[model samples]
Target: MKIVLASASQFRKRALDMLGVPYEICPSRIDEKAIRDNDPASLTRKLAEEKARKVASEHLDAVVVSGDAVVSKAGRIYEKPRNLAEAAQFLRELSGGEFQFVTALAVMHSQTRRMLSTVEVSDISFRPLAEGEIQSYIEKYSVLNYAGAFESDAVLFFADRICGSYNFVTALPVSRLIVFLRAQGIKI
Candidate 1:
């Protein structure tokens, strides 16, 4: 069966690469900012499903996969930062605090319209961060590309703890995806 990934995210692409299976990248052109929900889970799930469905419609014979990720803390939801300043601000807010990283995946079989949606949440705690450290991190990495201004491997630097799979923080959850593909009769 043909496989399609409905996102332009490098992180998700890298995760999918782990499967060692051929897939096509067909990013959804949907306006993501137009969709909003107070609940993080609902927001991510909807975005992922919408992306998958859009791409599926274009490739009727392929299985389309898509995902979305967000970080929520103190009732605030954070998506990818728009610029360096916003990235720094997000990192500041996440400093010395606990946040929930929510990632949702949607898989659709375009031919039959069979779909599956799943959500994963990771509890992350960051140690107290100083101004210099945050500045240094911003300079060293492209923080704007990641939700909450941090990457999965950032846990090795200043994160105090992580309570879920690293791939969840990266926004892909490959192990779960493997199971989903297997259930669809696709051999990886």
Candidate 2:
């Protein structure tokens, strides 16, 4: 079957590429800010499904894969930071603490109009970061493009511990995606 990725995120694309699948990029241009919920998992699932459905509508012959991620700490949900200042603040608040990185992946078979979705949650622990460190990191990388303002691999030096799939923390959970694809009779 034809494969289409319903997102523009390089991180998600890279994760999918690991499966050696030939897919086309068709970004689902949806207003993400309009979709929100008190529960992070539900919010991410909704966003992922919406993105997949949006792309699937255009490509009825392809299977559309889309995903969304959010960070939750102390009952507050965080999406990609709106600006550098917010990114810095997110890092500061997450310093020396634990947070949940929740990622939702959705695959829609347009012809069948069937979708399989899953949410992966990872617990991340951070070492205490000074204000200067946070500022330096932000200036050096494009944190505003990633949820939680920090990439898992990029922030490994300051991340004390991770309690789940590292790929999920990066935004796309590849293992889960593989399972979903296999269930749909797609060979990875």
Candidate 3:
């Protein structure tokens, strides 16, 4: 059976490539903003499943995989910033504090509609950052593409501590994804 990745995110694509599985990219066309849930875990899980289902519908013979992630602190969720200003603000707010990084992964056997989903939560803490530091980081990287303005480059220098899988922070959690794919009878 063929495999399909249900997202346009380069981060996810890069992570999936590590498995060495040949797959096609078929980004889901769902309106993510329309999906609402008070709980962070539920929100990410639903989004992940929805993306997989949306793509699976178009490729019934293939295994469709999808994922969604968010960075939250004190219950407020932070998605990708709209511009440099918001990116800088996000960095400032996340600095000197620990936040929850939630990643939800889903795999669907389109032929059978069998779906497996899991969530990985990581605690990330950043040391206090100065205004100049935040400004410098924002100017140096394209932080608009990632949640909490956390580009991959920021992971090493900005984050003071990480309590979970680094893959969850940078992209999809491949270890968990490997198990999900195997259960769907797809050899990685």
Candidate 4:
């Protein structure tokens, strides 16, 4: 089966590539910021499902994999940082604190009326960061593209502890994806 990755996230693409899966990239164009009044966990699943369905509507011969994440501290949801100021704020809120990275994945095949959704949770503890360090990293990485305003692989924002799959926190759960694909007979 032809595979379609319904997102533009480089990290997720890399994960699929590492497994030698040949897929097409078709980033969904839903206005995610417009979603409100839903819980973080629910939102993650809904967005993934929405993206998968949107792409599935256009392609009948492929299985589309889509995912979304929400970084939650207490109960507030942290999306991709809009600017340096918001990025800094996200860093501060997560400083020396443990938060949950909730990622949801959706696999859809329009031909079979088959759709699957999964949520993987990763606990991340941020190291205590200095103001200067935050600013420096923000300047270097340009936080417009990263969710929660940080990257685990980047030196400036390292997680002291992680309790779940690292790839899930990065926004794609590979093992789960494989399982989902197999369930649909879509060999990855």
Best-matching candidate per TM-score: 2
- Which 10 successive residues of model 1 have the least lDDT summed? 164-173
lDDT of each: 0.88, 0.88, 0.87, 0.82
For 1-188, candidate 2 gives per-residue lDDT tens digits of 88899988888888878889998999999999898899999999999999999999999898899999988999999999999999999999999999999999999888888899989888988999989989899999899988889886545768788897675544788988888877766788
* Residues 1-188, model 1: lDDT tens digits: 89999988888988788789899999998999999999999999999999999999999888888999999999999998999999889989999999999999888888888888888988889999999998999999878878888886676787898897665544878888988877766787
Q: Report the candidate with higher lDDT, 2 versus 4.
A: 2
lDDT of 4: 0.82
Range of the 10 consecutive residues with the lowest summed lDDT in candidate 4: 150-159
Model 4, which residues run further than 4 Å from truth? 155-157
Estimate candidate 2's RMSD in Å. Answer: 1.2
lDDT of 4 by residue, 126-177 (tens): 8888899888888888577877887655422467888876654347888888
Q: Over the stretch 1-188, how does candidate 3's per-residue lDDT look in tens digits? A: 99899988888998778888899999997998999887888999999999999999999899998998888899899888999999999988999999988889999999999999988888989899999989999888878878778866786787788997675544688898899999999987
Q: For candidate 1, what is the lDDT?
A: 0.88
Work out the TM-score per prediction. 0.95, 0.96, 0.95, 0.93
In the predicted model 4, the residue pairs found to clash are none
Alpha carbon lDDT at 114, candidate 4:
94
Give residue 175's lDDT in candidate 4 (0 to 100).
89
